[model samples]
Target: MRATPDNGLKIRAQLEREGINVPSLSERTPSANSKSDRKKVIMGAVIFVLENAADALKFVPIPNPDAIPNLLLKWLKVYDTVGGNDDGLKELGNDIRKAYATVLQPLELSEQIPPEVVRLIGGFHSDLEEQINEIELLKSQHLAKRTILAADITKRISGVRTCINNALNSVSTQATILTLLREIEASSQLTLERLPRAAAEHTYVKSKSACRPSTRVKIQKSLLNHLKEAKNRFVWLRGSPEIGKTAISRSIASTLEKEGTLAASFFWDKSRTGVGLDSLEWFPSTLARQLAIFNGDFKASLVKRLRRPDSELILNLLPEEQMKTLVIEPMNRLRGIFSASTQRFGIILDGLDECGDPDALKSLMNLVLLLDGLPSAFVILTWIRLHQTRLLTQSG
Candidate 1:
């Protein structure tokens, strides 16, 4: 076994054996805050160790000096006696290289090494370089996968939301309100915005003039209760022509509008002017116009048809399918759009008795039932009670 030296000499010998070209231990350690003095001592010791070892061993240091530096680091880590000293190790490495170069002639260590050594060192460098490239590629691929997955998940969630909203909109009248309430649960943003102000306004009008507050409250309460449960009931208000039937229907329509409700009202009359139900073709056109007003995209397309020089011709030329497409589809679409736009809307018909065509009344009712799929509508008929038998006798 080699004799161990004092701390200074032991460090020098270890550096030489481990191929660590640095100064002795004392020179490597700094007196508190004396970094320059510490650096000089460590550097001087490394130079001496490398030169002495080279002369004694009869071998030139390798051209690739990093091998010695790496070996020194491994030795320090493995040796429990070595303490924390990264700077010292680095200084040692630098000094080793410098000393070998300085005593070039004295050491007789200028011969180039064999191909096997060069290949061994070059192989390690190539492996490290390849590993770095692989790591960079893996990082890029992981980021790309994460971004794509996030986008796909977001799109699916949005699609579900849209489907839910569309279904809620298609619900007619009070069903519209109820469905919205369900979807939103505790949030009032959607429900409040959609509730029809017209419905509330009509209620206000009916209640404002009553002399007794209790009576007004009772009537308002009754109306709300009726409205809440009247979704599937067929309603008929039979009275004289000038009685409150039309007024009530108007009130209902106004109420539904205010609540942002979806509703359609048809008025039948004795007059055969183009305005009455006699001009059936205009019915779908009028309904489509209403739908277009509520839905912006349909407005421009519908307007194009309305403004055509052959507009009347086009309207007449509309096939039953086309008529259904324009009028019936819009009325059906109103179930959703009206509900979305307002809370409740339904069909309100007044003056059915005045139409003098009982068949028209029955036909209109059938159409309402067929198109709306629910009886949430309000139909007010003004007719002499005495004439009810004639109106009711029709096969329509």
Candidate 2:
């Protein structure tokens, strides 16, 4: 009831004027241009309505002054889906609070009202203050829940992929493309950045929306809790192709990232040929690079370990040695530093089925599972390879 057809037309017209055409009404989240001006106008209308109502109802008996500002935001949000006018709205809230204080300015209340009425107002104020604090806590929890819920709903509706091969649209290997790929295949001391670039140039799964939160909600929750138990040191998710294994893994990584627990991510694939499969050989070194960036001692130890005369040479160190020295030793020190239950470390391996080399995978699996004896560390393996199940059980 707050927004009219004319208001909708005005918003659509402004979007068209700015060449910000949203395809459907369902896609209500605003584009960048429409986010500000369009929301500003709607908020302005809401403020105007609140002002008019305040003036007319001034003489009528009212519940409380607090309701007035809350009403303003409630009515404003009825139209603006995205918080485009967040800063302006915050300023307005402050202004309304100041105006309310001015009117209630601790003046000669005894002269105008009975002592009982004054005491009642004071009690109401205290109750309102308590309610405000409670609302703040609830608001935060509710927002997080709603965010996860909305993203899950949107992805389910649209069938958005958890990950996609963007190799076709990747940055051009324009000059000597053949040479570049061959170099990658031959290279042993590659950095973490090239790993992602080489591994099929896939979508980075930047945000939580890269996951379907609802479908995986139960599993994700179970996994986190399971990590606390002894049996969850190695958690494996097996699923058929296109069955959302990658999506769930991405979601798990996203969750761990938020919790400051994600140590590293190495997503594999068959699409990028040399680069993707090449990742298998240097996976430990890549993870070491990632962890070193975050943990200083790990960096120092890693540098020392890799600084030997052999490092600058052909880089022919065995995979297990790389895992034990480059990864496990540093991670051991890290575990000592962050021994609290709240502090956790996690590694994610996705698309394990796509690894062309079985021996390389066996090495990686053995390396990953070495964390079993360590506290507050977990390894997540996702993908389907029925034949490899026996190998995995044997490794565990």
Candidate 3:
């Protein structure tokens, strides 16, 4: 309970002297005629308290209206001095004592509801008070509900948000699966568009592994035949340091690709001076990247898939059949722009002698060749004439 402005303080002091909790309000207060009667008694005692303060200041010099602020301070000083056990103050105290009995008369003498209940009942009072204040405005003006068009627009916005969430989730799931697929095998390469979210495509490239054929004519002819026979193939070209096998293979691949007959090609250029021996997965990845330039969604999807660490691609490299089952199967299942066109997929693997591990190279080439069911696949293996030339020649 708090003291009311000025008058209530004096009433409170008087009530306290009588061992009555004056400033506190609770359900225990006795009622007189009604609750209103009890409030009137309290207010009356408060007014009488103000009268006591007026009498206490009778001896103080009155100041001009202009000096009221200073005069009020002086009046308070005198009141404080006379506050403790003064006869006049006690008389003033008696006045409230007499008033308390009357003030408390309106409180009914029955079992009381706890004070906590009273506080809880007031929980919504602030909001009710604000609404009551706005009653005048509500009476003067009509309030309107949300318009039908506004409601419909809100519903549509919510629906669109849900749809966007669903789309993102699906794309994320696809990316996770594709990346896992990339880790497990290297038979086919996943290509993403070079835009935002570049992990949608699994990032795996076929190892450039092949035994080079002896002649450029044979390389060209073998590549052509592989293109007709398989969709994914590895062809290696072998020759001495200055041999023009790479140039010839590139010319053939580029021309065929332009004619929409070849899906991809990797020609290792000795003069160009970089990592050579491109084939299988690497070739198709380049092709897919180039193709993705025209498709933004494809680029974003590929990027998203490439970023996933748990991609299947990392796991598919164990056995040849596993590589086929995981990598090649998924590649064959891809329904994209590349498959929509009738172009054949070709890989030109150049420079077998330049590769560090020839046996591993041979295994990779063999795996690509053994990937069955892709009729339009082809690989052209290029290498320098060496001790391994007989081996390649015998295999051919």
lDDT of 1 by residue, 1-396 (tens): 111224345455545677765544544343524755554454445445544543553454555434333332233222112122435344334433332333222224536644443444344434434433433343346556545434443333233223222322322233446557556543422322221112111222332231333334453344444554545334444566544554555555565566655344555444544443443334444445454444454454444444456444544453343345554543453344434441333445555554446555554444434444322342222223446545454522
- lDDT for 389 in candidate 2 is 78
Every model: Cα RMSD to truth? 28.7, 22.8, 26.2
Residue 316's lDDT within candidate 3 is 41
- Per-residue lDDT of 9 in model 3: 51
**Model 1 poorest ten-residue lDDT run:** 192-201
Name the lDDT value of residue 49 in candidate 1: 51
Candidate 3, 334-382: lDDT as tens digits: 4464456455555444444433356655654454455443333323334
Clashing pairs in 2: none
RMSD of 3: 26.2
TM-score of 3: 0.32
| Lowest summed lDDT window (length 10), candidate 3 | 195-204
Residues 115-176 of candidate 2 have per-residue lDDT tens digits of 33334444434443444443334334656655643344333212111110011111112223
Model 1 score (lDDT): 0.41
Which parts of model 2 have CA positions greater than 4 angstroms off? 1-209, 228-231, 276-279, 308-314, 373-384
Model number with the top lDDT: 2
| Residue 369 in model 3: lDDT | 50
